[model samples]
Target: MTLTLYTNPQSRGRIARWMVEETGAPYEAVILDYSTTMKDEGYRAINPMLKVPAIRHDDRIVTECAAICAYLAEAFPEAELDPRPGELADYYRWLFFAAGPLEQAVTNASMGVTPNENQQRMVGYGDFARVIDVLEQAVGRAPYIAGDRFTAADVYVGSGVMWYTQFGLVEKRPVFLDYIARLQERPAYRRAAEKDDAALAAAASGDQGG
Candidate 1:
């Protein structure tokens, strides 16, 4: 099986990289730049959205970081990233929650787009505070998002928690920080981060030499 990941070190592609690392699958990485290669017609054929973090497995293409995580978990089940029997509910729940509501709320909040009570009804996440409260309760409930063991859910959710807290996009609640701390201990997480950091450094060096 041939698997290829198209990503940029500076984008949400890092989350996809982490999920790929968690799957323990052999794959090739094709790094793209936002201004040029990513938007080129050749790359647009792969993803019309013109975004990083898309993957091609054989002939099948998958885009979006959340979808990539879920796909990789199922694709490499031997890695045990897929949810266990009882974990299905929580697994999908928090996975979509992070992908949809959490992300929407955070992005809107970051752009100073708080919804009024009436607008909240139309917004899927209701309000930023509500989303944060629910998320806090979620991580506080168990060792992992899907229960006792880490699953693809944590990879997506943990990335959100880590990024959100780091940028102050969300309130740096203790629960969020603690949850991120647990995920940081994973070997896959560390490896993925180091790879991205090295990629970033390489890009910087190239720019300097130019």
Candidate 2:
């Protein structure tokens, strides 16, 4: 079955679009308006949360950017975006870490909401500083998040790094700068960016016309 991606250009769906590009998958992009289309019943059925970036492949539906990235990588092994069985520990580890701890840390810090000491213990990310340090060290240790070879983990983690750095939510350490440089060099990344940018422009034009 042909894949269908329900997405908004400015949303987290861009990450999924990038993953699809990396997979070299032939997919249909359904661009939805954030305010109206996302709340529609049809889209909501695919994602109960009424979120963008949901994908339907055959009879299966997948939501969440990280999950979609992993799914596409495994689904299209000819793309070789995932690590082999023996080398999957780092792949799963960093991917989940980015989706969980790293994401939460950056979100909380961006909103100026630091957890108290007790709250920190209970929080999955511990503290923002610790999360930052661990992620920085992990990326610095290797060329890619899952080690030497680029994997789906990099798609998720690299998106986080790019967004965080762009928003000034995370410090632009040499490790992050170098990693992003490598990611930007990929043709898939550039194609994804251009596609989303054009979508965004079209949406803006529509708004103006209305």
Candidate 3:
């Protein structure tokens, strides 16, 4: 089956790109621009949300960066990104935790949307500080998010730590920096970043020429 990735260079699509690279599978990338191709009717057919980073694996369509990471891990078993028997609990637990609470907490904090004490009960992450503390504990507990080995969960959570820290959305704690440093050293991660960086440069050059 052929895998196709629909993404933009400068979005959460980078997370999906890294996941695809980790699979070591041959795939086609369809780059979309937010104001043009991304909003087109044809693209909307694949994702009504008009979002990038959606993948078409033969007849299957998977959207959301976390979902894409998890789906690709399962789809390409040879990649060994899937969790082993002993790692199952930590794998699913942290993966969903990063996708749900962590993301919500970071994004909300970035936009100055902190919830009050009463409102904290209604939110899944409670508060930004608590979320950061929990995340610090998670990454500090092991060499990888799911256990001693790296898995698809790291792709999502690592990307979150990398991006959040770089952009000041989250704190640059010793643990987060250490975790992301390890992940950044991976060949697949390097390759994915180079590709996106080239794309971003090309887009900027095009804008200047026009």
Candidate 4:
């Protein structure tokens, strides 16, 4: 069955587009305007949250950027974007780490919210410093997140690294700089960037016209 991708240029949907490019999958993209289209009834049926970056493959529907990355990797085995079954510990570990701890840490930091000492214990990310240190070590040890091979984990984690570093939300350590440099070298990543940039430009022009 043909795949349908629901996305907005400015949203996390860019990550899903990159994953689709990596998979070499032919899919139709449905770009929704941030104003009203996303809240429409048709789009709401696919995602109750009315969010972008959801995918429909045959009878299956997948939401969430990280979930979509992993799903696409598994769906297209020829892409070789996932580690073998037995060697998947790091794959699952860092993917969730980026999605959960790393994301929360960055968000908290961006919002200028620092929990008290006692509250830190209850926080999933502990502290931003600790989260950065762990993530730096994880990527520093290997060229890719899931050991020697590049996997879907990198798509999600790398996107976080790329976005965070670009906006100065995270420290630009040498390890992160090098890792993002490597990710940028990929053809799929370049293709996705160009496509998103064009989409954003078009949207801006449309807004100016109306």
Candidate 5:
């Protein structure tokens, strides 16, 4: 149990897999069933919220997807998955911004609640439209989220963007489309996806042989 990842390939756990793939680190995966996995007393101890995609890095347990991605990237520096020192500031800024505000806006939009102008003033993300505009401006200006290079920040933001784009949950703005194209083309991402896909296929076959 060097690093234990409790995940469901179909959930936010995929984000953790992306990070782990970027790190090029060795870890074990424990696929869980949707019906009973979360309720098992042992899994609850790993994440009180009974969330998927929890990680155990040796003795430290990290539950949230973003925290797990950020921590793993730094913990395995040889992987070079984090922003360079100069770009680190913007990296942190957009990473959490996307994780927080962008997520809220997406979820809110799915529920059919467009914010009023007055409510927009108080909400950090403003509205779904504004969130798209802001992210478009930043990503369009730089090749990657953190200036010139890909980082752990991209891993999180990219995952959110990619999913939203695929599901039509977010608008297919040029910036969003281009960003996902680039992220998906990365060798590391491709490799990780292949592994996860295989694991999922195997699990479906009732083998879980990996």
Candidate 6:
């Protein structure tokens, strides 16, 4: 598989980076800085929407973080992080739930635009309280999202929780705090983070010389 990932370490693409590391394949990774137009006409040819975490898998180009992570795990099932047929429902459910409610709530919280509890139906995530309640139910039940075993869902939710916490979009609840800490202990996450840090450091040193 001549896979090439176009990503930014600071973006949601970090989840994709961990997936690629888990893939254990000889894939090329291109890191884009904030100054670059990742969605510019040139890069947009790979993904017209111009999003990071896009990958060229042979002839199949894929975009979006969770999509890329889900796809790669299946494409490299020897890696074993892939979801099975029976887990399909919950896998897609939690991932989609995260993509929708998690983003809306987190963005609203960051912008201080969360809806009042009474007028929640007027908002997308129905206020941060509702969002938190829903997550507490789903997450608190699991050895993983699909239950009993780890799957690609963890990668997506783990990243979402980690990011929202970083942005102070979510309250520091024990469950989320513990989840993030546990997720960070994954070897694949360590590998990608180490690579990203080293690359960032080298780039910083280069700018100093210039």
Task: Compare the candidates by lDDT and give the number of the best one.
Answer: 3
Candidate 1 wrong stretches, greater than 4 Å: 207-210
Per-prediction RMSD in angstroms? 1.8, 1.9, 2.0, 2.0, 1.6, 2.6
Q: Using lDDT as the measure, what is the rank order of every candidate, best first? A: 3, 1, 4, 2, 5, 6
* Model 2 stretches with alpha carbons more than 4 Å out: 207-210
List, residue by residue over 20-132, the lDDT tens digit for candidate 5. Answer: 88888788888887788777998989888887999898999998878887898888989887778899898899889888999989999999988899999786788898888
Off by over 4 Å in 5: 208-210
| Candidate 3 error regions (>4 Å) | 207-210
Deviation in Å, model 4, residue 23 alpha carbon: 0.5
Clashes of 4: 0
TM-score of each: 0.97, 0.96, 0.97, 0.96, 0.93, 0.88
Error of 3 at 132 (Å): 0.3
Give me the overall lDDT of model 5.
0.86
On the 0 to 100 scale, the lDDT of residue 24 in model 3 is 100
Per-residue lDDT tens digits for candidate 4, residues 28-142, read 8888887788999998999999888999998899999999999999999999997788559999999999999999999999999997889898988889999999999999988
lDDT by residue for model 1 over 1-210, one digit each (tens)? Answer: 999989899999999999999988888988888899999999999999999889999999999988999999999999999999899999999999999999999999999999999999999999998899999999999999999999999999999999998998988888888899899999999999998888888887875221
Which 10-residue window of candidate 2 scores lowest in summed lDDT? 201-210
lDDT for position 27 in model 5: 86
Cα-based lDDT for every prediction: 0.92, 0.90, 0.92, 0.91, 0.86, 0.79
Give candidate 6's TM-score: 0.88
lDDT of 2 by residue, 5-124 (tens): 888888999899999999998998999877888898988899999988999998999999999999999899999998887659999998999999989888899899999999998888
Minimum summed lDDT over a 10-residue window in model 4 is located at 201-210
- Candidate 6: deviation at residue 104, Å? 1.2
